[model samples]
Target: MALTFLFRFADDVVEASDGSLYFSVASTKFGLHDWFFDVLEANLPHGQLLKYDPALNETSIVLNGLCFANGVALSVDQDYL
Candidate 1:
């Protein structure tokens, strides 16, 4: 199913060779209005990397416990995260 929850802090997205989408979430504990603290101090490593598989209409948590994960880009050949 499609994502029913608003991402806490979706910062970036990139399309994969398989047509899936990879994105970044700055912090799950804070929104855009107050994300500064999450990155600045209050919370560290609250970021996450998500993957959306349109073919299956599903979204999965690919990675977590990241430190303010802001920008995300898949490696060439889509071999690495």
Candidate 2:
């Protein structure tokens, strides 16, 4: 039998009060052999900022292709969100 795996690399994350989670995923390429070597070739990790709202049970992409977007924070008023 063949086995399958799901690999996800998350660099940073933040949570919102409305039961929402925001995070960034870094770009990575891998092979069966010496996968760690690929990390060096990743250069600039490009990915999107995602928001998962548990109340609505939906995941939305707030921003895309943000290079090196490591942290996220909401506005003080929360109204701007």
Candidate 3:
């Protein structure tokens, strides 16, 4: 069977040196299907950045209270994020 809700409003994704996935969840109470509404409700923070370690099978919140936390990315040298 297929699954959904992997992450609500995941806007962007990037990879890290430790084989981890970094992403942004653009809303807490809204999903991608309701992305427009979230955008419309701008100025308020409902977004977050997360780190997923495939090896450890773990997921953690990196940042929160973001206003449309899109374009999740790492530094060029992978030194700062």
Candidate 4:
């Protein structure tokens, strides 16, 4: 299934044991081409970490206010993100 969210800079993605998807949004205001600009400006945190549930067909923001949410991964024991 194709899905879209408010964020356009989704970069890293990791799947959990239960099939949930965890991803990172680099920046809400900028794309890869303007990554330097995003960093140079030092703007307010616009990045975010998100979660997607296949069964529910829903996406939710797990965390926000990040400078640039680039990579995402779960803990070894799957106890944390």
Top candidate (lDDT): 4
Candidate 1 per-residue lDDT, tens place, 8-59, comes to: 8999999998899999998887888998788676446788899899899888
Ranking 1 against 2 by TM-score, winner:
1
Worst 10 residues of 4 by lDDT: 1-10
Model 2 local distance difference test score: 0.58
Cα TM-score of candidate 2: 0.58
Model 3, 15-76: lDDT tens digits are: 98889999888898688788878788887778988888899777888887898887876889
Ranking the candidates on TM-score from highest down gives: 4, 1, 3, 2
lDDT of 2 by residue, 1-81 (tens): 422223244566777777788876553233335435445555644555777778877667777655545567778866644
What's each prediction's TM-score?
0.82, 0.58, 0.79, 0.87
Per-residue lDDT tens digits for candidate 4, residues 1-81, read 654677668899999999999989988888878887667766677789999999998888899888888899899999989
C-alpha lDDT of candidate 4 relative to the true structure? 0.86
Model 4: what TM-score?
0.87
Candidate 4 colliding pairs: none
Candidate 4 wrong stretches, greater than 4 Å: 1-4
Question: Candidates' lDDT values, in order?
Answer: 0.84, 0.58, 0.81, 0.86
